[model samples]
Target: MKKLAKACLLITAVLFAAPKVHAQISIGVTISANVAPPALPVYVQPACPTDGYLWVPGYWAYDNDSEDYYWVPGVWVAPPTPGYLWTPAYWGYAGGVYGFHAGYWGRHVGFYGGINYGYGYGGVGFGGGAWSGNTFRYNTAVVNVNTTVVHNTYVDKTVIVNNNVTVNNHNSFNGPGGVTAQPRPEEMAAMKEQHVPATSQQQSHERTASQDKSQFASVNHGKPNNAAMNKVGGSHFTPNGQKAPRNNNNNANNNAANNGHQNNDAAKQPNVQQDGHANNNAMKTTDAEKQDQQPAQQQQHVQQQQHNQQQQHVQQQQHNQQQQHSQQQHKQPQQQHKSAPKPHTEQKHEK
Candidate 1:
């Protein structure tokens, strides 16, 4: 009986230690840090190298091992789908410590702690551009796009913004001296809507940034040398860097010379490892009992957050249904009036 109890407890611990994953939007515990993250660095937006690419703004990301902040260089990336917009993460102070909010790819731009991550993300709805069908249009006023390559664009200087949130103050978080902005009603809707996780390329870019010492604020003091890149990986693609062309000819000499050479250091970045530090200590029954006693507060807080999420999702569903109905009403006549070869119907009834 004693052996069986011990085995069951070990199994329970293993299951609890594994991270929980959800199919749609990932809602997890907010990570907390004692120190406030460094201020946002000033960087020029790199031109959209190709069409269908969206710019992800630069921000400070915390490393668990170093316990210091590092700058993840902004890069233009293609979203998981055409309509999805990138919601940049932000730090918010609460419970006497700052918590990191993980961003997600949602149908609409969600509240990002009201941090104005410029270049179209001015602390509210995305001004970068809108998607027409499968093609993404660029806003030339804020977003830098090559007009020759990207023609589906317009000059919209007056981008929509929130009046409540301060613009361009350069505070990197939400609370205290930071931008104290709450999630608006529309933003709350986006939070509960279906979301897509960050792409593998984006994850790789973050991992690469974590490895770079120059990107750390302590080293460069908020102005990173490699501030932005055209692409995520597959090149040393700084906005101003020497370009080295590779010879891919099938000749025996060329093939032999390039066989051992590796390209794009960013492409070879390792996966972001878990920050768990395992201690091989035997469990005590009294300690387990003490953990159970503390569950009341933890469970209450989690339950409250879950309730808020459920309410938001319910409200979003209703809003979506209404919008969809309105759209159908508008399109019904246009669809009917469209010039098309009508299906033939027999006139036997009149006869």
Candidate 2:
């Protein structure tokens, strides 16, 4: 009796640890970090249209380990069948951090944090059409019609987003202190229903190509195409949302090369200053030699003034360095010294 009780408790714990499944909907908690946000890149669609497909909007995702965000571009996807609707993906703030909830298929267009996926998927809900009987009529403004791919369904572009246009702006992409929206009853019901996970083709189409990886910020775990998720260290889901160490081998290499260049630049600074010093000294010596050891009164005064000015400039440079270096805990001291002006008594005596 005691063994059976222990066995039952273990099974119950395992079930609870598993991700929640409503109908076909399976949501998993992922461990990621507070990362620097990524810039939004322009996402353009191919001029031509493919039939029997729906559009999914692009978004920026945070990668915890890398401490960076990567943009996920929107693309055209075929509906599961003739009747299913696409639920746009959205992120919700929970426990003082944002949690990403991917879009899923449902009987109706569900709430997705009011993310406007472009076309007719504005913040409120899907403006796209629904299925009736054996036909599906999509809002042409939002969907491309290639009579070839979808024959039974026809769209009137005249009634759609005029000129097949989509709008994206701050007003639509809500930021801090912006509008807050929640899913409606119908949308919530769909979310509760068993979800059908995104298809393999859909998953494949969403990946970032290897060559294009550099274009995005490091940290996104999903391949967005080849693999459902990156199996690298710190890629798995954790409760605290702490991510593992980032794989910055490439970044480190680049940084090393950059450091080398900076050092080369520093090495040349003194050479440049020394060259200027040498040129000034040569000009003075040349003038003195040309005069055949006789000091021209006006020339002597001018040379003295120029020399003083150079000394003052060097002093100012040193002063600036001192001010900047004072805040640092460890910094190399400046080695170069400037020549000082001769005292008035010495100058008069020489005259």
Number of the top candidate by TM-score?
A: 1
Once superposed on the true structure, which residue ranges of model 2 sit more than 4 Å away at CA?
Answer: 1-49, 132-135, 147-165, 171-179, 209-211, 218-351
- The local lDDT score (0 to 100) that residue 123 gets in candidate 2 is 64
| Candidate 2, position 70, lDDT | 48
In the range 1-351, model 1's lDDT, one tens digit per residue, is 543553354334334432311111123223445688887766667678899999888778865444567778778998999788989888876545555677778789887888888889888788889999999999888888888888899878787454311147669987779886777789878888898878999998887776666556666677666767777864333334334232222132222222222122322233312211211122355577778878887899999999999999999999999999999999989989989988999877764
- Model 1 whole-model lDDT (C-alpha atoms): 0.69
Tens digit of per-residue lDDT, candidate 2, span 142-188: 54455555554545454333243454432222223333565567766
Sliding window of 10 residues with minimal summed lDDT for model 1: 272-281
- True-structure lDDT of candidate 2: 0.47
| TM-score on alpha carbons, each prediction | 0.59, 0.47
Q: How many clashing pairs in candidate 1?
A: 0
The C-alpha stretches of model 1 lying farther than 4 A from their native spots are 1-30, 160-167, 234-351
